[model samples]
Target: MKWTRDSYRWIALAAGFTIILVGYAMRNTFSVFYPVIVSDFGWTRGSTALMYSLTLLVYGLFAPVAGGLADRFQPRYVLAMGGVVVGSGIALCSTPTSVWHFYIIYGIIVAVGTSLIGITPVISVVSHWFGSNRGGLVFGVLGAGFGVSLVTAPMYQWLIATYGWRSAYLMIGLCAIAIIAPVSLLFIRRSPHHIELLRQKDTDTGGSGTTPGLSGRTEEWTVRRAFRTRSFKLFLLIGFCNMGFAQQVTIAHQVYFLQDVGYAPMVAASMFGVFGVAFASGNLSSPLSDRYGRVPFVIAGCLSTAGSVLLLRITPNPDSAIIPLLFAFASGWGLGVVPPACFAAMVDRFHGRNYGSIHGTMILFISLGGAVGPWLGGQLHDISGSYFSVFTLVQAFLIVAAVLIVFATRPASMRITS
Candidate 1:
């Protein structure tokens, strides 16, 4: 069976989008359970936070393995297995009777599921199908899954409210299997080669039958080669620092911080919706890097994220309209630029052959930062009794991230050019 060129593009996009949606939906469902799980289980705040941290740690650690698997085997199979694991884990979560149960199900199983179906594999697939100009746009559009959870989270919350948390987990698990499994089996193909007739049609029409502007040069640096490069080291440092700040200030603490600043629980949750919107908006800006260069967008985003941290620190009240506006702008700007720039740069530097393995390794550092951020935030809040210390620390991290980005852009250093 072969697909037409147009059909191939659409199928690839759909596959990419499906992976994003399922992974993000599973990841964000945790927030809806936070309050309820703590109350019912009598877990300490730190203990509950640890579960999420562990999830991040595992997801990050396993990403490289997942990527390697995708590289070695079929992406569709990897994704299908991921759906099964994640759906089962979430369903099992409905029956947890102890903290370790949450740890094993949510922290370990679901984390493995996420790594398999999440951005690491999706990005690798997308990189195979698109070139420089369209790549950033494609990545941005697909990456919008991270934001999709904003809408899904509330829906999950409503489901939990209507039923019980246990029922909610079961339902979400069912949804994951129903949605992702079929999509993976029916639509996902490893590459354009899967569609022979489509290739002929494209070649007949004078199309290259490959991504436009792609050199088709498969010179890929292995994980060892990538690590030996100065650019890779700098990227790891930048990713660690930037993700640490973003995860701590936005993903982990924003809800609690909003509550501390006098907003109701519902309001705090709504603010996450706004954050999602900002996140999507920021992603939209990535393609612009194709025209203006990745350096400017990367620098601007890092600086803006730093500025947002400062705004939160200095604001008299986070509930104030001005604070939300500033936070949204900064966060959106940062989130959008970092992913596409970082991804494109790596591919450009290393080329496509080893993209999965190299990028997967980089994501491990990003995941490590994400794992530490929330745990550190919870610890700091427990010690200081306020978000001020955490915000200050985030600001410092962002500043360091910005400095690393500048260092990354220097001439005479290895940089990726599409």
Candidate 2:
């Protein structure tokens, strides 16, 4: 198929959406895998959960390096290579005999692979296809991939039940390799500039479809300059507190938490699926942030998410299904809004040729927060004998997140480039 400048952006979007959906699914499956790993090994929740913390830490630390690579090289090669690494690492997981083996294999290897193919690089590539005018909308569409990945929770549970965790992981790894590699290589491009350059050779219109690059109008934002700005610092805080810490606390333990309270494993997984669907719904709604404003949506999302935890805390009957359904939908929708809006707001302020590096650095702080959350939740549970303290902490961080965004998105902060 001949790639027109107009048509190729959609193609890139679709490819990115697919890659993110599959890649994040691999990460999200950890929730379902959490209990099984614990049951099989009889490890303490805190120690067993530490592996996940290590994974987030490694992925966070490596994100800047991945983004730098995406900026300097062809994204196709970078993403395809990441797919291979992710697949290999997950497949190798079937062979680990000790907990430390997981720390090495899943924590370091798979984490690095995920960083390579994760939101940082994918957002960098997609940003090239559309200008900041559509950043929220396009990013919402892309962010939906993360939510949709969660929708596969039931399927993952079925795999674990039917095939056993080891075999299920091997199958998932193979699928990741098969799906991510070709789509990335065949469809992802360096930027619209390459497509426009080809279009210019074919006609005199000079590729009018291409969105203007940020560097043309704004002062170039190097990684160092972005770090110096107050907005960037606030963004880092929002990412760490809300996006990383509160979010990971839920993602890593929601299913297990539900099971501990009363719901059966499969039922808990289904509730997670409901959460995923609602999350996708919120992501689709994020385009409104582009119209109304990013900060309001973020603050609303944070409050809504925190409120959902209260529903979980007050669940009159986990057996009835209504409360879990409400909690899942409300929390998912609320959690979904902040990420695309926050990142879009960042793009509104900081996007440029060096944005990949800047975004990667932002993700690093988020990862650090993420690294703490799961382990902390597990430790809190270990000490308190319930998720009560864990849920309370989530609400506290989310509220703090909402307050921080108010400062992060201030008009004075938005105007600063250095």
Candidate 3:
């Protein structure tokens, strides 16, 4: 039997989504092992965080190169190589005897591995598989994989409990190989056709605003050229501030923060879970931007997230279960909304030919932020003896991110040649 274009697109979409979900699950779940690794190594929180920071830096730096490889070659091969590197690198961490080893192995090696099949490449490839008219919804589904992984704290905790952290590393390593490698080898594909031209949706009636491209010409851009635009620079700033400060600070320290404030580890994970659920909801809802417009949703999300950070700061009891959950819900919703919207906005302007490379370059900036944020947060905690200064920084970053979202609307004059 033969499959219709519509039928197989959905099937491929599901496979791609699952692959993304699993890939991120392996990467994001590392935080659950944070305390254990520190205790085992007798490393300072700052130093331990340094490893994570270094990893993010390496991942960010390599992301664009990976994107270019995917564009130039076949993405499946990249994904396949990523599975081996990720799995093996993670497994090797089980034996590392020093923090420097971790910095080199988990930090550098794992980061490089994760970069290849990461959001930048996957979305770049998947975009080709779907129609531009449905781009918002398709990418939203893809982004949900990363958002939902935020909820996997319990699973990570259980793995650590059932098997020690070393063994847990081995488990995830094996899973990465078994799951990601096979899926990539069997199910993933390169979309051989050109992307359907973007449909400009009218805000008033949720209908197509105009035909594709500028003045009836399909505009394309290069990664280096996109960096010359005002909007792209603003986009870079938002990515940098958000990833470098807000997200890394939260992910690296929030669990420990909850514990410092009298919450148990499980309770801490629960807060992350709440954030994850709200985040996943946001990802799912972002597709509505197809009708509603991407910028408004991103702006709303940035404001909501900023408000949550402030609320967390002011909360009389970080120990109060209900309050943290409420804050998490709001924070998660905001972050979840921003990613898809931001990604779509980039595609709207700088898409075609070098989109993967361009997206990768953006990821590079975001990675720089991720690399710096965790280490900075850790140092601040050591100096101030509280998360006050760290969250203060997070609030400031969110403000910048919010402002950038407003200006990152597609640049009317931006265009480039391959």
Candidate 4:
């Protein structure tokens, strides 16, 4: 069967989804490995988590550069190199005998590799293929890849249990290299124009279909001009508070918290999978925000996520299965809902030639939060001897995030006419 213009968009979307799934899975597998590594090396939780923090830090720092590279060059080549680098990083992780070795391999190397193939660049590519009409749904589905990657948590646990962490890392790394490099090189294109899928000039709508400006005149936005606006600044805070702090803190430490509260390791891993399932559901649901408006979903997602932390704090029950299930689903859905809606909103406003760079910078802020969150969660746990303070801080951040979303999405604030 030959690929047509109509079919190629879906192909590109699938390729993007696969890249995100495999790349993010490599990063997330660290959660499953956390306890095992600690057990093997006798490192303090705070010290052990610092490696994860370093990855986020590096990922955040490099995101804009990755975005800029994707914007200026053939994204396939960039993504293909990312596949090789990330795979090598993961594979090399198996050989680390010391903390510094692991830090260099997983923290800096893997971080840079994944940043190349991550949401910033992938979304930049997809934005060119898709327009505003279906942008919400498209981004939602694309973002779902991240959530679905989490479903592999249980599998990672099994791999570690059966073959050991080293072999598991090696196999996963090999698979990433074999799969992502080929798929990205073959199927992913920088834009629809590369494939000869040309729409009418009026329908071009840039990458994301429509500009947020009511003028209907498409204008290009440089990073500096975008920075001068309040929306971009608000989004930076949103990314930091929501993606960086809340997400990183939760992802890095949720398994440990569950295990600490009397749940077995396997059980905690399973619960992590539950969160992934719910996260995909919430992620996929963001399309509704296109119709109803982005603010509601963003606010609701923030509140729901905040409430889940509160739920876990008040009702710590390892004996009953319900609490874990409820916490996982609620938190996952709430967390999942925010990003696509937020991304869609960003694209609605800022999609242009330089969107990749703008989006990458946003991820950098998120990475900064991510860099701090896991380490902070670990240190807080070490200091308090419980997650009580950590949960409180998460709730506070979520509330602030909710407030930021309202102001960020306000109609009066977004008057960026060309």
Best by TM-score: 2
Q: Estimate each model's TM-score.
A: 0.87, 0.93, 0.90, 0.92
lDDT of each prediction vs. the true structure?
Answer: 0.73, 0.88, 0.78, 0.87
Q: Which ten residues in a row have the lowest lDDT in candidate 1?
A: 193-202
Off by over 4 Å in 1: 193-219, 314-322, 415-418
Single out the weakest 10-residue window by summed lDDT for candidate 3: 196-205
Candidate 2 lDDT (Cα, whole model)? 0.88
**Candidate 2 weakest lDDT stretch, 10 residues:** 209-218
lDDT of 3 by residue, 1-418 (tens): 6766666677667767777787777667657788778778787788888988898899899999888887766678888888788888888878888889988988988898889778877877777777566667877898788777788887777778788889888888888888888887776775545322222322312646443344465454766678777788888888898755677777778777777778777778878877878888888888888888888887888788889887767644754687788778888888788878777777777777568889898888988998888998878877778888888888888888887777778554353324
Ranking by TM-score: 2, 4, 3, 1
Q: What lDDT does candidate 4 reach at residue 267?
A: 94
Model 3 segments more than 4 A misplaced: 194-218, 314-319, 410-418
Clashing residue pair totals per candidate (backbone < 3 A): 1, 0, 1, 2
For candidate 1, report its TM-score.
0.87
Give me the displacement of residue 72 in model 1, in angstroms. 1.2
Q: Cα miss at 348, model 3 (Å)?
A: 0.8
Top candidate on lDDT is 2
lDDT per residue (tens digit) for residues 172-250 in model 4: 8998899989999898885556333223324445656654443465446668777877888898999999978998888
